[model samples]
Target: MRILAADIGGTNSRFAVFRVGPGPLEREGGLTLPSAGATDFISLLERVWAGLGAGPEDFDAAVLAVAGPVRGRTCHPPNISWGIDLERDWPGPTPCLLLNDFLAQAYACRTPAVAEARVIQPGTADPRGAMAVIGAGTGLGHCALLPLERGFTAVPSEGGHASFAFVGPEEGAYEEFLRKETGRPYAYGDLVVTGSGLSLLHRFHTGRDLTPIQVAAELRPDSPTLDWFARFYARACRNYALTVLATGGLYVSGGLAAKNPTVVDNDHFRAEFINSPAHAELLRNLPVLLNANENSGLYGAALFGQRALEHATGLEA
Candidate 1:
């Protein structure tokens, strides 16, 4: 079946056409466009399909993953300006599925299409346990894959917006800064661990305004910004792992870590990730992996599309 998959994050939107059935899933064509330029998803989708030289009629199914909570057929992504309502905006007579972006990442675990994920923590993993997926990009995302009777079920979360835990005098100061910077009652995970958070952290240390890319590019040997970001990133991962009891594994899948792996691939991150006072041993035994493939989202969306198609036809076992 022809599946048109779209992975829409806060910063960038990626679209691809996949042939998912009977054989290996295949990609025909795709495009990545900046989500900043457009005011709506359908218009940007028009440009994306146009760039691929194919329109909606060419595909039998579509799966759209956006970085926000999905309500029925509509979603208003937190980071992006525009929201999408498949019921109102989708064109042509085709099947379309809406999903939270992190939920799509959850479905991506162990899929052959996005198999080259890197290993950060090589701990023992329970094959039947639940798996967690977290990533930092335009924002922070959290989700999990719970092992079920026959297969796995993807659970979406909006925990990134929840209050972030801060400890110690140093982190307490940072929390105050986060509150002042974000003007929120409490510092949330998305604001503390996202790309903008990196920039804000850098600004806190250096008192200079620099883009996330610039900060990453000008890293010194002992850059405090990277160090703190790594610690927080690890803390976020560690918390999510414990919350899900992700004995199967914990996969970090996001553009931020994918682009600058050093954030999650260092001693600082390692120390913080396994630093549970009561359950350190339990946390230490779970594998920590990173999906560096930016297109893994698209792969996941297509995989989900295939699954949905099968279920609709009562072919799912």
Candidate 2:
């Protein structure tokens, strides 16, 4: 089957064409485009279609992994100006599935596509247990996969929007500073653990506003901004693991984590991640992995598309 898959995050969107069936899933062509220039997903699709020289009619199925809370067939990504409705904006008559981007990544866990996913923390991986995936990008995105009889079931979450938990005096002080800076009572995890949040943290530490890109260029060995950023990310991961009881593993994906792996490579990162107090040991025993492959989302969308196509045709298992 010819399947088109798109992984739409808050910052960028990726498009790919895949051929899946009784053989290995294959990608025919793919492209990455910035989501900022366009006002809506249809416009973005036009650009992709023009670039690929193939329109929606060329594909038998399509799946979109959107960076937002997917309600039914629609999505309103936080940083992007546009929202997507599958029924209203889908390109063709073939079935289309809209899912939270991270949920799609969770689905990719079922494929050998993520076989190279890096294991940062070595621990027991319980095949039957639930697994968690979290990533920081235009915003923090999280999801979980519960092991089922035949495969795993992906569960989408807005855990990134949950209240940020300040664990230390420095974090508490930073929280106060954030409140004063944003005029908000509480810091949301997305605001303190993403690329934008990293930039904001850099501003808080250096009193100079710099985008994540600029900050990356000037980050020093003693950069408190990155230190705090790593801690917050670790804490967020820890919290999510606890929330979902992800004994199978915890996989971190997203532009932020994938780009700056050092954030989770140091001693402080592991210390923060395994610090669950009462259940610290339990947390310690769970594997912590990072989605090394950037295209996991697209691969996942293809997998989902294949399933959706089968279901719609009454051929699904």
Candidate 3:
């Protein structure tokens, strides 16, 4: 099947055309364009189509993994731009599928071996139970996976916007500091674990304001601020694990976590991850995995396209 897939995130929008069969998808051509450079998503799609020498009606199916909520055919405003309505604004008359970026990542998880996904925590993943996926990139993205008798079902979540909870004195103080800086209420995950969140924590600890990239560049094992960030990050992961009963294990993907393996390897990270109030044992044993694949979102978009086509036609590929 010829599938056109796009993984749209805050920073970049990547589009690819591939042919898929019993084996992996073979890439025909792809392009990565900056989100800021495009006038709008439709213009971006036009550019992609032109660059590929293909028009809208050329593809059998199309899938888009967008960085925001999708309500029916319309998406909530993307964190980076005004909302994009895929069905209405798409370039072609072919069938298209829209999915939350994280949900697309979950579908890609079904074929974990295709990519070298690393296990950060080793806990039992009940393939039959609910599984959670959280990623911190341009923004935080979340989703859940439920196993059905036929296949796996994926659900997207806005849990990243949930109110922040402090599990330690440092976090509590950080919360107060954020309130003063932003002049708005902050969620723990929103303030401490995201790309901007890391910068916020760095400023709080060092009294030096820096962008997320700068903070990452300055991060060191001995730096007290980086240590604190690791603690809070692990705590947030543990909290998410417990809340979703992610016995199917927790999969952490995205640029933030993937680039900072030091945080995941630290003792503080593991300690915080297992620090459940009553059922510490349950939380402690749940496996945590890091998706090391760089093209996870792209692979996910392709999977979403394939799945949606199957559902529509009642034919399994």
Best candidate per TM-score, number? 1
Better of 1 and 2 by lDDT: 1
Return the TM-score for candidate 2, rounded to 2 decimals.
0.95
lDDT of each residue in 205-240, candidate 2, tens digit only: 889988998887776557787677878889999999
**Candidate 1 colliding pairs:** none
TM-scores, each model vs. reference:
0.97, 0.95, 0.92
TM-score winner, 2 or 3: 2
- Candidate 3, 1-317: lDDT as tens digits: 88888888887788888776767667787888887778787888878878899976888888888888887666764467656886578765787777788887787787642267777777777777778788887877788888888888888987777776775686678789989988876664655678888888888888998988888888888987678777777777777777777888888887787787676667778887887679789877788888866567888888777666656762222
In order of TM-score, best first, we have 1, 2, 3
Name model 1 segments beyond 4 Å from true. Answer: 313-317
State the weakest 10-residue window (summed lDDT) of model 3.
308-317
Candidate 3 stretches with Cα past 4 Å from truth are 112-114, 313-317
Clashes of each: 0, 0, 5
In terms of lDDT, model 1 sits at: 0.88
In angstroms, give how far residue 298 of model 1 lies from its true place.
Answer: 0.5
